[model samples]
Target: MQENTGAGYPGDAGVTDDFALAGVPDAFQRLWTPHRMAYIKGGQHQFKNENDCPFCVGPGRTDEEALIVYRGRTCYVVLNLFPYNPGHLLVCPYRHIPDYTDLTLEETAEFADLTQTGMRVLRKVSNAAGFNLGMNQGVVGGAGISAHLHQHIVPRWGGDGNFFPIIAQTKAITQTLDEVRQQVADAWPGETDAE
Candidate 1:
């Protein structure tokens, strides 16, 4: 707290000194301020609007319209809209349910099958040697879309992680989403199976 002159005492909160002590450059600090203000509070998320919810009616609407891999009776696979890698995909159920408990037995089975198929397709498309399969069961952990449950199959390569994500918060770069979608969709179940 900065010393307040005798007329009236107002706290300084130490914000300026804290940043200065930490050696944050003035040019870098000014550059980051505008980016912080860009968020629109209370904006409707894409999934919240059912009319435009891609996981529900969007997959069945068209083969090319949605990037769905296999449309099962209860669930389907779609390329991630924003992905960590080229072939990143998520297996989501038709019903907008949040957790594993909400999914029916058939829905669960379909998700499992699609996850396996997605991994296989990723391996072939990206020539990836390994995959990191995971899910966020609920909020308070990692479920960004807590109202809709899904599984991610992230294709891994030898040097996928360099210093960017760790040091500068910069992500590893990627190919276009359309190209990645085309590659995965083209290698449908009927296409090829590695022995």
Candidate 2:
């Protein structure tokens, strides 16, 4: 802590100056997101084995509990627990494969289909103007959970980029993950229609 030498300020005399270390105020306003500590601290999202992998374990639970939007024979669409935007989604294969090349023919086909359906559902439910779609293969490739293969479908809108995400490294999600999951799930097209 800085020594309070009764320095310059309006009321310097006899004041304890508990916040002496706080220093001068600036034009920036801080947005404290305590919820993000889960990601930073390595919560359930961090998995050491396939048995605990979120993508593998998520399907065993109910759709609401898993934040799953849609299910197929070989793949499923679920809302991203740590989303870049409000309706960000991930299409993951049922198997615990670590890379895209590991997927079987059937898994590959369904994975691609589910990604398309997820994008359509996000557009219909959230009126998203654009999307960011890709897959992070391994730890070095930026996959948070590198034990599973999943494709990201991040919905985007005009002016979605703000000082918060760009400068502060924080994104302001307008809705809860469950809310987005339900909206996207309800808007999902039937199997026949999706094709």
Candidate 3:
């Protein structure tokens, strides 16, 4: 009797009599970040009062430490520490308001202005194909930091999304936060009409 050889598999090259298993070869590469476990596990600290909020305390921190890209009078732009994409940023009012309606006219204007500027700067610096820009208002709305109001500016590339994010729930941020912050800061527009 003839024995079966795994010739159907792409890279099997006819499995030997030793019964070794082979996998199909592909061009895809993987980037695993187990460190994100800490961010995921520390869920208790995410939805707290203003005093304990990162956005409330963020302005007081040094630009590099806080990953701040630009500081407007009423609003500021900061890099997202846990980014969905490489140059992901967040535009927020200094006030730790939980809702959009809580913003004053000045705060609202600057928030909109800074968000626009962040998109422009990200485009200039990273040459992003597009962006995902919006705010998650509450816990039910998918806000990780529900006590603070902030708009996310996620830069998107043509083929950035892949199996990893879908299958493993991992996003591969290509650049470090500090590196992206500096690049965006340098390319930021100066004295815009919104200012």
- Per-candidate TM equals 0.68, 0.74, 0.74
Candidate 2 residues 26-121, lDDT tens each?
Answer: 678776666555444454355767788889999999999999888899889988888989998999988888989999999988998888778777
Off by over 4 Å in 1: 1-54, 166-169, 191-195
lDDT for every model? 0.71, 0.81, 0.81
- Tell me the TM-score of model 3: 0.74
Name the lDDT value of residue 139 in candidate 1.
53
The 10-residue segment with the lowest total lDDT in model 3:
10-19
| Higher-scoring candidate on TM-score, 1 or 2 | 2
Model 3, 64-180: lDDT tens digits are: 999998899999999988888898899989988888999999999999988878887778788988999999787667677877899999999898877787667777777778888
The Cα RMSD in angstroms, rounded to one decimal, for candidate 1 relative to the true structure is: 7.5
Q: lDDT (0-100) at residue 175 of candidate 3?
A: 74
Better of 1 and 2 by lDDT: 2
Residue 141 C-alpha lDDT in model 3: 71
